[model samples]
Target: MPASAAKSTIALIGVPLELGAGAAGTVMGPAALRTAGLRAAIAGLGHHVVDEGDMDVPHAVPEFAPGELANCRNLSDVAAWTGEIHDRALSLLASGALPIFMGGDHSIAMGTISAVSRFCAEAGRRLVVLWLDAHADFNTPATSPSGNMHGMSVAFLCGEPSLTPVLGERAFPALAAGDIHLFGVRSVDAEERRTLVERGVDCVDMRMIDEFGMSALLRGILDGLDPETTHLHVSFDVDFLDPELAPGTGTTVPGGATYREAHLVMEMLHDSGLVRSLDIVELNPFLDDRGKSARVAVDLVGSLFGRSIVHRPSPRA
Candidate 1:
């Protein structure tokens, strides 16, 4: 059983700009989450909510080295953003507040997770990541064809050399390769596929979702968690859901988890109480209609914070 973080203060820190991804519109995700009433929702659960507001991220226009993968672009600004987020995340952890990182893109995980890793290393606790995304996101400079940094978040976090300098003095802290779990993956490039396979990464893809349903997958992941783990950061890319359910993401994959399926995962996560931090990334409001995607994401986060569908009791005739 994991020690509950009930007494901890929760901070909603938004990185409301996206130069780190292949598309636009996700920069609006931070505001969307707040507009969807994140602070109020979390407070509804009897927890104190504090909105630290958005972090200081650079504009998408590039200034730094695009590096070996020129196509990925934004390398310099992304690196600088890492430094900014690293400082903020470290402060949040030291302050004992459970920081819920509102994302501009998945790239910020490289910063948030890295800070958590460093804290855990010194304080003596394990770091666990539940990477729930549609794509594998393991691409490196050599392996990546498109060179998008969002596609390489997992690769960078695992201490891949292509992103070392981006670690920015925080390189000493990182998680063991086996501690990360890649769940709900369906799309994979040839290089990412090979790397994930060779690294012995635990990936429960859409096929598995089809074969066993979400309950079994949740059971397997929860079973792997321990209370001693310092933090369980859930990096949820909206693309993990089928485009039918979540259509506003940069990367849209077919056959995603239905609403009920997504709700169940969040509900179970709430039950486990292992999750500490989170990322709601890849939601592109520019591509959405009447804020459909934003609303769904809000509902899902509600489930994570202990909202349920069984609020009413069945009546007998």
Candidate 2:
């Protein structure tokens, strides 16, 4: 059979995180996307699909009150979710299926990405992260004012200290600075910005996208990827969309990537065929204009799986 004729399996795991942001509505992300038929939609593309449902994250009735900078209000809940999802993802991969985590919050990236990294590492494969977000999420407990774990997810994934323990006894999945690529970033703390620059992470900010054109900048990004060399994880934050299109996101940023630009990125990713995992994070349907944000998210996932422009999951030869 031809390589392109092979089909693949995709498992959906939802992570609803209301503990990581100020706007307080992302916990509903999983259900929202699900209600929008995230599962059936992907399955319709002719891939094997399994809805693992949502991970059970306990409420964070804090044992101790949190401080200003140590904003660990829901530390236990987030940590527990991290542990459970890590194992869940690993378990799913062991079943020979790719995992697509429907996120509760951006903080959950710690678990979802870490699990995929460990899986690839054990299999002697390298992992690449395509971080699509408005903020860098590279803050540390010491540096963050809000201490929202979501704000600090990227920093921890790249081997920063303070919270690697969330991966359980096994180590957190850390990456080489060059392996992680950040796109459409418009907001960054001064310290996080400095850290990202010092570490040499590939960040194509909104200004860079505007200056160079999305297609040109994206070409450079795609050219940098060696599909044969990587298992890509795309972490798409709802905030990555302009508020006009995805208003459900808690951290709505103005002047985000337009709908067309967003689709182009997904299409390129599909063409590369390097994506092995995905995350649809930070959708706060409470703020949504109907179900517009969730629909767009589903559409983007559709593009990643191959829509009219790209085509569904092809076999890895």
Candidate 3:
């Protein structure tokens, strides 16, 4: 088992801004997670789970004009959410809480990661992002086939010029491309694949997982970390799981991780005690089958915080 974090407060910040996504229902993701007992599940792990509630998109726009990225849709709205979330994330970290950034879409990562990067920089620590998703999400506005900002999140965070102004007046510590690791990826755009190779990112794709197993591939990632100096941030997109198991996500990719495979990943992360922050994104409850996906997400969170299958407690009747 991994060591436990010294910090006891788990702050939940919901980013219910969906304009970053190509779909609509992800705006309700936070509410769905809460409804599925996320807070309760975390509290059950002996952590103080504080629900900060969903962030409200600013009605008043900032003075900095949104970038005119041609292929990126809803640039202004995404920029607004990015700024708001960045502020909130920094505040949560300052309070000495391990923040769980509940997302409306994968694009919200632009804010969460930006804030964490800044916080780590100020603390003189290194920030490593674990991107668990189906797609690479490394497309720039110029390379993106779709106009969805979610597809361009990874690119933006790595200092892509297309969305450079998304952070507004606040300074963004752009993450080093090599520090971002992609896991469970099975889908990638032609251009995005090229970008990943050019950036020299460490991607443990489905093919590799099939060959060496998730545990071995993930262990390689965990082994390289310096637990004290590395502030690990896990950006989990629901579509990283096979659609048959997590059908609520808008961008469903086939041949993703199974339920047990995902649980084991979270369990390993729990033992590592290196994760300081997290982002649970791209869950669209509107497409779910009676909250099945939400329940699975909750279960995965349970595993992340040290819930083990062998010693699991029984639910109330």
- RMSD per candidate (Å) reads 4.1, 3.1, 3.9
What is the overall TM-score of model 1 with all chains considered together?
0.91
Candidate 3 has its poorest 10 consecutive residues by lDDT at: 308-317
Error of 1 at 102 (Å): 0.9
Q: Model 3: runs farther than 4 Å from truth?
A: 1-7, 62-68, 311-317
- Model with the higher TM-score, candidate 2 or 3: 3
Q: In candidate 2, what are the lDDT values of residues 1-317, reduced to their tens digit?
A: 21112357888888777777777888888999989988887788788888888777654332323443345546777777777777888898778787888878898888888888889898877788889999998888778877678888898799886665545476755888988889999998899888988999898899999999888887776665556667888899999999998999888889899999999898777767677788889999999999999999998888777676534444332
* TM-score, one value per model: 0.91, 0.91, 0.94
Q: Write the per-residue lDDT of candidate 1 for residues 140-166, one digit (tens) a residue.
A: 878877666888888888888767877
Higher-TM-score candidate among 1 and 3? 3
Question: Cα RMSD for candidate 1?
Answer: 4.1
lDDT of 2 at 155: 85
Q: Residue-wise lDDT of candidate 3 within 1-317, one digit each (tens)?
A: 12234326899988887887877899889999999999999999888989998888788564444345866788777888888888889999989888999889999999889999999999999999999999999989888888899999998889887678777778878889768889999999999998899988788899999999999988888876877788899999999999999999999989999999999999888777778899999999989989989899999998888688686432210
